[model samples]
Target: MEKISYSRVWDLDKVFIGGSKSSQFLEHMNRLVALVNILESSIKSLITPLSINEVIKVVPLIENIATIRLYLSQANSFITCLLAENPRDQEAATLRGKVAQEESRFEKELSKVKKIFTYTKEDVWESMLETEKLQEYRFILNEWRENADKNLSEAEINLISDLMVDGYHAWGHFYNNLVSSINVNIQINGKEENLSVGQAINLRSHHNEEVRKEAHYVLESIWKEKEELFSKIINNIAGFRIQVNNKRGIKSILEDPLKKNRMKEKTLNTMWTVISKYKQPFSSYLERKAEMIDGTGMKAYNFWAPAIKSNRVITFEEAATLITEYFSQFGSELEGFVRKAFYEGWIETEDRPNKSAISFCAGFPLTGESRVFMTFNGTLLNMLTLVHELGHAFHNHAMKSVNGLNKRYPLSIAETASTFSEMIIFDAAMKKANSREEKIFILDEKLKRSVMNFMNIHSRFLFEQRFYKERNEGIVSANRLNQLMEESINEAYAGSLEQPSIYSWVWTPHYYITQSPFYNFPYTFGYLFALGIYAKAKEKGKDFEKDYLKLLRDSGSMSVEELVMKHLGEDITSEEFWEKGMELCVKDAEEFIELTSS
Candidate 1:
């Protein structure tokens, strides 16, 4: 109702008065450390195979630990915002390490708790869960107990947690630092200028063909120069994970990711099978895209290039207005939440140097708020990304009142809200386009997203799958890694692209994440899952909004198959469900080809 001055910089002062130097934040960390120590002591002193009375006592301790972890997460979220705002902030980085140490401490205690649950009598465990205090956490508690079967002894798990602080996780931190330090010098407008990796990557989508080509060439060269170092980082990271999984008697790397995603192997297999069958329309779309751009075929650089030249740049205010307007079309609750986020400075979109290239939405359970981080360059794609992150924020908002443990949704479903948001805006914008070029531009953007989810992400998934298999035997050479990447990309794209990104493994951050393995497939899963939900919304109209919110609320507490069955009444492990989603993509690709033909 009122005009708000949109600021690019987020307001972190309200969350913590000082950035990394905040005494309040330091005090909070100190309190968290003390609580973790208490939790560890309590877990250590607990008697196993206890009576019902002891179960009640342990439940309260679990609740306390959860509360303490929430506060720790709040601290971590604040430090993440600071680091993203200014990557060179050494103090923030130091705080991050401290937070990691505290997290390790908490996790060690949690392992002990899980051990207790693993050994507890089923009757007592069920009775404990039936108690009023533990009723809401029954799902997550049962899940933990079930997963504990896959874990090592409590002592071994604690040892792994301790070692990870300076071992596995350290490599991930090093990779981030190396990525931040990357600066490329490329000729723009006949003058050479330095660009951060984030800015250089943004140039891949530049309207000018030559600029995009140069950016790609320079980036490839830079990564190639540092390939050996990256190779070691990735090898060690994978090596550490492989050893851990081996110790746990885990047979495949996908087991961890599948369990974490609450998805079955059959569902993953079915989805890929469906995707493999539907590659023709997407290939046709790429062929048409190349024809429009006067290129012989699609190349790695041309992957993100705009189909038509348009000088229009959507500002932050305009992007926010567009998102809220489309979001309101779905539900007033989402619209109101987004407006509140905007007015409260919950998003950081400042286009500045020394910022992380990745975009994320960090939720603070302690405050029941979320912070979105991204570098906005005023393109339609950037607006869509903003909407995507806002979707995550809305999901967080939907679960704000749920128990902390139940709010830990897997990465698979996490993308549902964000991708759904993107579809809403893209669909609305397509319908409102006033010219052929505008329509093409919007459609191209939409198809670009689909290409990314289906083709690009698939390549990463394939590369990781092969790399781990080879890495199991021994260390993979940089050259071998490159070959794997290229081969995977070629296959994933179905030989559609003229040039495959061979050195992607050297620069892609997802491969190095220590917390999650195969961080690639969940994205495709989420994109397709959201498409299915969007199609349902179209069929059900405004009536679906209530059910949609309920789905978000239940996301953290159920398996992928169970959640889909309960919410959408479809079996995720079936080809019919995946085909429905793939059909939507086929329609878009067919429409794009038909339009461009004219």
Candidate 2:
């Protein structure tokens, strides 16, 4: 069994000619802008109650725009990769600016078509859907009309899109840059060193309890200094969104995110209702883990505490073999895809300074390719992240033949495949543990994530809901933000911690993104959704593999509820479906408590 080594950087030439600065890349951008102009011109000339002949003429233009947008997506992925590898790359920064401008222009042009579709009477729109050339795009075209109905006017929508570049999105970028610039000076083993925000935060999971506490205080002090700036950033972001929602005739703040997620409000509410009932098991697990660490119960800092240290550094090759081996039990298709991704230079795993500390998989549906970015530190967590990201890549691969428009699934369903892949690796790790200590360590790790995905994420969801509700009135102050966060944590955790991470909202970047409001709950949604699917896999054995792949493939073509019901034969809009997922975590929590106390 020869172990295959993974590459530190992926090949972008597969998607585009040369690199970002290449003449071919420039040509692609120019052509995309030209296509955008043409599309806008063609759409603006169209009249309402569009005849079938007019639709036929317009459909080709829309398809051309979709093709050009695919090229833009490829270029965007390439620029992000370059920037992620070296944040100081001036070339990458320039290209990112250009790409952003073109994307805004392109989106505005696409909105015009949406406006046309909105104005078209239902019979006319349905008649257009029946056309042979337009039938493939029925899902996308229909969705645009449904969304457009919520807009003020085509002119206003375009104005907002243009303003968002400097007004809305600029705030998000500023927060990112501001956070990146701050460094915490921490003394590790009596030697003081300045650590980036991410490095300092990771220290909370350090094996030494003292180090974890020191890291917590250092991070808290750093955030405290910027609390005022963070407060303004959040308030303004929320304020901008609220204003937009109000003008769009949306009353509830949740309306935008729920719509974006393609999930019913009742479904989200039902999921939370079930989660509230299952918090005690997680609280008990946290308490026991804290008790094992010390006589004291859970402390705010101890939430990230590690199990007994049997730490061993793994190599990239070993991680690949381990992941591929476990993935094979699901099916050889997944095994083969993981192998191809590694061998074909679709994964970037460089461990370097200034590299982004996050991991994401970008799907290039037009090219039938996907790229994964992550720093591999060879820890168990890193291995889990590898498979987790690979899970996302696999999902993208499943949808290779899906229509370009249909490939864009909501965030709630996006995590389904990744979490499913993680379960595979996690179950394998637990089975392979060589000692009682190792088993406890594995269980603790699993319990810790369950606590995070369920309780911690749930707290953020609650905090954001309250923050938006209050922000609707006016601006929320820094002190009030901390109070809201702590209140959410206290209620969600049920006395699991001595105190909450009061300034947690100050650091989390999700709340700052203008494009994706309420980004926290999707994680919980995906985790629970995957758990339900994973349980089905266990019960049905290998028969579940085809159904799982089919679910992933159809993810983009339909809403989350439709995707779930069509494939799994379950209604996601009910408490019964959500309760099954919640029970799995509670069961894990009970097992964790029993093992640790034994």
Candidate 3:
């Protein structure tokens, strides 16, 4: 174990915190002013030379701008949690908030500088680093620059970016505020207590079925009453996005996200093709889950109920050893990363008062370090979270070499390494199960996730697609949104987890985040991608392991298609890649079903 302490370092660290104080903020402000002056003086040189050397200098300079903003945004993230944790720390919080604005301004200026570069695929290849180590990344760099057709005109792009902060994101903020503060009239354990929607929704995971049911009713009832308002918000936001996409000459709403994600249409199609094809295995797994509950009919509330195999509990320390040992088999580097995250005071995961009861891995974008946040109380799921966050940390470590443009990939790729890491740990544990009970527990959880990751996430993606399409035509009524959601859910989870998931809205943050529309498909994408990669690893054994690290390294560089092709020797645009991956899930489901039946 490592010694843990509180940090009041924001006001003190000039390295990361600039705008929080006059001196610190002035330092960042001065850097911005100086950067602008340098850029202005060389304006003629940039357009005139258009030399490859100029692009090199400019690219790293852009990386520097990104690095500074990344660090500052991460600093603000801590302040955000602090504000949430202690409402009384108003003065410091106010200063911290201002620094966030300064960071945003810095980002805008950096974008302006990047825009000046009339880059081409030839230029990116020409401007790249001369290293045997990274020579392979040249094609990746070239292809990315070649995709600039997707980039909108400078003025329109800037306007859209700015509008996002005040216009689109504001609605999301409103939703968060409304849900967070509103006291819902909920009857809990025979008493009517004013409960927060988030707090009430959490009850759905409780062991007491009645308590979960009541919480669901109260929360759903409240949300139902406000459905009209939420529907309007969704409609307006979707319309705004469509209008922007149309102006950009982007044919589909999905195209913008796909391009923004640096992913190819084929890779996304490959994923859906794979997911939809595997509906049978997923539904079967859900049937097994349904059998565990009483006459509840595998209702939405029951989806979260513990499967027979999920009742095991492990201490945090035990989880650390499990994850570390499992990943160590892959390589020494992964093991060391896990050790640093779990035992070196790098993670803030204790159950504390006034702390939000949610778990997330927040990267300190400046230091290339990440903090794993969760309230740990020694459950099987908690252990899984411990492994999962360490996986995220390892991913940050993986991209450390590509500290420039390749580090920020799409959300689907964002979670690939983490979930892959968890799978590594989970598989290792399942292999070690010594008894029927242990095997069933591990198998049950594993089988259940295969369904949720593929089927449930797939459905959410469908709903978002339909919702966006309908919203583009006109403002969809609240009732329409409900119908869309229900249709997608029922179609995807057909004969799986009850008619209505007590979970559809309660288990997710997607509906509330009007800013990031269609935030659901990434889960399925990452899961299937990882599963596919994992299967390949099994076939090639140690040989595949060598190239696996290479794929993770280049994840920061190329589009999803290029990366998959480079490493996996498979095209991601076709359903074939996904089909192979989905097949592995089916294999696992068969094994689990066989074990349980026997």
Highest TM-score scorer: 1
lDDT by residue for model 3 (471-497), tens: 777887777777887888888887565
Error of 1 at 257 (Å): 0.7
lDDT of 2: 0.80
Clashes of 3: 8
The segments of candidate 1 whose C-alpha lies over 4 angstroms from its true place after superposition are 1-4, 149-151
Q: Quantify all predictions' global Cα lDDT against the true fold.
A: 0.87, 0.80, 0.63
Predicted candidate 1 versus true structure: per-residue lDDT over 156-274, tens digit per residue: 88789989999999998889888988788988889997878888888888888898899999999998898999999999999999999898889999998999999999999999899
Query: Candidate 1, residue 570: CA error in Å?
Result: 0.6
Tens digit of lDDT per residue, candidate 2, span 1-598? 6645667788878877666567877887788778777777776676665666667676677677777668777778777777665666777778878888888888877777677777787887898889887787787778888887445676788788888877787788678667766667888888987766666766666677888888898888878888999999998888888888887888888888998998898889888888888888888888788888886889888777665664477788889888888888788789899999888999888665465545688877667889888777566767777888899889988877776576678888888899899988778788788977887777877777788887888889999999999998899999999999999998888878775679989888888877799998898889988998888888887678888888887887787888788877899878999888888778878877777777
Estimate candidate 3's alpha-carbon lDDT, on a 0 to 1 scale: 0.63
